[model samples]
Target: MMSVRDRLEEVFERLEKRASDERVYPKVYWAAARAAADAADERRRAGVTLGPLDGALVSVKDLLDVKGEPTLAGSRIFRDRVPAGEDADVVRRLRQAGAVIIGKTNMVEFAFSGIGLNPHFGTPGNAIDPKRIPGGSSSGAGVAVAEGTSDISIGSDTGGSVRIPAAFNGVVGFKPTAHRISLKGAFPLSYSLDSLGPLGRSVADCIAADAVMAGYGALVSTPYPLSGLRVGVPRGRLFSQTEALVADAFEASLRRLSALGARVSDCDLEDLLEQMREATSRASIASVEAAAIHSDWIETRAAEIDPRVQKWIALRLATTAADYIRMMRKRDELTRAMDRRLAPFDVVALPTIPIVAPLMAPLIADEKLYNKTDTLVLRNTTPINQFDLTAISLPIPDVPLPVGLMLVARHDQDRRLFEIALSVESALPH
Candidate 1:
């Protein structure tokens, strides 16, 4: 077995190598990590064990505060901003758990896009296929883990930001319900919808990381029995416009689960879908909130903002107070409608994305293509956010292309969702 010191040193060495080779991480904290690593090693030598993530290497999204480091949130807009006074709540927890805090990974500008593209700091290419996107706003967090620079990545998921990248990059991403994890020092995309999650190589790794971030000591998830487990599939909208490869693999996965004694059923989601449609009829709660957060910057520093991001934030200016109030009301109604609808089933399963990671070239060249593709990429995963639910995206094994199987639960059912996800993850091909 490798000693904690040896493991962390190895991780830091890899971080340096990865930093030189890729644009995934814009900053590196070797000095801090080295000090933390030595401390963890000392604790181990004294027979004092740390938390579950003791001495593990971890990277945070730049959207978080790391005490003394200015969070760029993947934009040049904050290049001259002052350093943070303290770590974000999640980062503080990780440090307490003895994790070697490496450095901040890059992200989409202000976490506005599902497709990870940052003109200021280069977009991190996908690990599996460099030609395709690495999904974002947690883009670099996903790639850091995929490239083995970090054992786990702590990221924020507002609207498929975490899970979309996980699917596209072929990893596991778990988004806990909003308010479950502290967001005190993290930059906000949508106050109402934002949640913290971890992207890792496996379901168990994510469980461990989540426990640390949630201040729950260690991971305590147990696998639920798969036999006779009721897995619901939303009948419509989820599968519309899905690429053929994703459709086939998702159905095949269901068949495999059924073979393993799990009962698969198509859920009657007409009413739930209607509520969701109303909830998201116009500008997202994110755009409005982001507009509030960045309006001053957009007004005076318009040239500094990403055009795509600026356009979305600017839309929030057009949102009247009446529109905001109606949106909130619809949000409440939809959350309740989906919660009641999911109460009877153990979990709901859907394709994480109806499509694979789209190529980056065309999207970069054409604004129209970027808008259409971004909508498609976020379609399946965004509903979980609208309903204030928790979800995990697990890659389908043995598939010709990377496809994620998303399992969802009602709000605050994060533990139950993890148990269910583990069982399905085990049954699915690696």
Candidate 2:
């Protein structure tokens, strides 16, 4: 194997060639990355390897800490913020596991949008189609993984930040159950909902990154037999209203799984999802919690922030405490009910997004169009977060633009979800 330093230098050269592209990174830590990799190479010579992830190049989202870099979160508001005093908890763990940190990827401003539009740093287009949105808040993370700049990209998924971009970029994105990884030193959009995850080329890559982030060696899921596995398809808007090509691709994936001996059936999760939608509609925890975190900045620096993000956060001033309390109570009840509804199946399947990546030009030009498209983009993936569950979105091949099939599992059943995804991924024809 080539030395880790060699690999990191190659990545650095490639990044420098595309120095003007903000879609991929905030800053390239060429020296630090090379130093880390050199240390790893030394350890390798001494027979002290850090398992499969040793010497790997990885990307961190801008919201994550990295000792001396400012946590921009893709907005101008933080240009003057002090540099971090130390690496975030996840960065600390990745370093210990012998991974070389390449750079910080750009994201939606404060991780509030699903469209990945960063007005301050310029919106990063989709890797598959430069004209389309690359899925939000983890936009640059997805691009870094798709273009092979990083072995894995670590990002946060408050709603669909990780999975949406993964779906758009044709990579595997895993959103572990909240609390599975530490959030210390990471900027929070909604501390109540923010959770960290990884985007990579395959399920195995995500599995390895997740393990390392949790302070361990790579985790392995036992090979599960496809035969007799029960996968549920929820019957409602999640199953309907999908674009022609997207629906066709999702159905074809289901057929392949069924042919592989898995029992695919439709179930009524409308009540569960509906309750979640209603509660969130009344008052979004993301908006209220974001307001709390930005109260000071919103008062003094609203103009410096993205206008759309600013408007959304400002609306929290109108939210009543009673409404927030009611929403939380309802969310708890619906979460329990949804878990029970999905308990009978090994996994629940859905199209990660109702439509493929949309062109950014028209959406950005029209507020109505942007809002409508953003809601559609987030509709399917947000419910999983509301229920505090885990999910993985796997890319579906044979399409012009990428499409993803999401497999959702009960809260804290991340390992089980990975196994199910592995079986499905293997069954699909590449």
Candidate 3:
């Protein structure tokens, strides 16, 4: 077996030789990672394992603080902000579990856009194809794991930040129920929707990192029995406009699950989805909260901020307190409504994104295309956040490009969702 030190050395070599030229990782924790690797190696030799994450290489999104460094959250505006006094809760937990903290990955500015373009810090290209966009705001986290520079990468999923990148990079991304992992020391996007998540090469990889970060203690989740498991499919708005390839891959995965004795049926969520959309017609919950978070800088530093992000947040500055409050109330009522509606199924499955990683050139050149694509990319996964559900995106096997099979369950059903994912993951073709 290779020593942790040896693996760390190889990771360094890969990163040094990577085509993205360190764009995927803006900051590499060389000294700290070396110390952690050495410590893990000693523990391994002493037959003293800290936990499942012992010796694992982990990368965190730039949105997370790593003690003494400012949490940039992929923006240039905060470059001179006060450094953090402590590590983010998830970072502290990963260290406690003996995982080697590799570095900080790039992300969308303030984690606002799903298209993963970062004009401030060059966006990390898709791991599968360099010319394609790497989905984000968790862009670098996804690329790092996909490119094997990190075994597991941590990201925040406000509205498919983690899953979008994972889907584009062909990896597993798990978004736990909101608040399952502490967000202390992480920069805020949408206080209501932001949730810390992990992206990795497999369901088990995510499971290990999730267990550690959520403070669940060291444990392996047993796969839920697939036979007779009820799987629901929300076949309306969420399913509309999906690229043929993504839709076909999703349907094929469903058939494979059915063959494994799982029950699959369509569950209509259009009415509930319509109601949620209507409630937020004025402004999304994320934009309104983000506007408040960056209120001081939105106008004074408008030119410094990403125009796409600024436009959305600036528009929300006009959101009446009454409108925001009413939307929140409606969202709560609808969350419960969806929960009751989903009670019959173990999980609801959908494509994580409707399309593959798009070429970066066209999106960069055309503002209209960028906006349309951003909305479409986030369309499928955003609803899960609005309803406060736990979800995971599993890479479908044998696809030319990456396509994610997203599984969702009611809030607080995180472990159940993982167990189901494990079963579905094993049954899918590799």
The CA lDDT of each predicted structure is 0.87, 0.88, 0.93
Record all residue pairs in model 2 with backbone atoms less than 3 Å apart, i.e. clashing. none
What is residue 236's positional error in candidate 1, in angstroms? 1.0
Worst 10 residues of 3 by lDDT: 13-22
**Candidate 2 structure quality by residue, lDDT tens digits, 1-430:** 8888887877788878878865578778877888989989999999998877788889999999889868887888887899999999999999888889988898999999889998777777788888999899899999889988898999999889999999999999999999889999899998778999999999989988999887767787875788999989986888667999999999999899888898999978877777777788856888888988888887578878888788889879678888888888888898888888888999999999989999999999999999889988998998888899999999999999999999999998998898888888888889
Best by TM-score: 3
Tens digits of per-residue lDDT, candidate 3, 162-235, equal 99999999999999999879999889999999999999999999999999998986867899999999999999
Clashing pairs in 3: none
Q: TM-scores, in order shown? A: 0.96, 0.97, 0.99
Clashing pairs counted in every model: 1, 0, 0
- The sequence of per-residue lDDT tens digits that candidate 1 reaches over residues 237-331 is 88899998898989999999999898899888877777767766788888888888887787678788889888879878878889888988888
Looking at model 3, residue 205 earns an lDDT score of: 94
Off by over 4 Å in 1: 14-21
Off by over 4 Å in 3: 18-20
Please report how far candidate 3 places residue 104 from its true position, in Å. Answer: 0.2
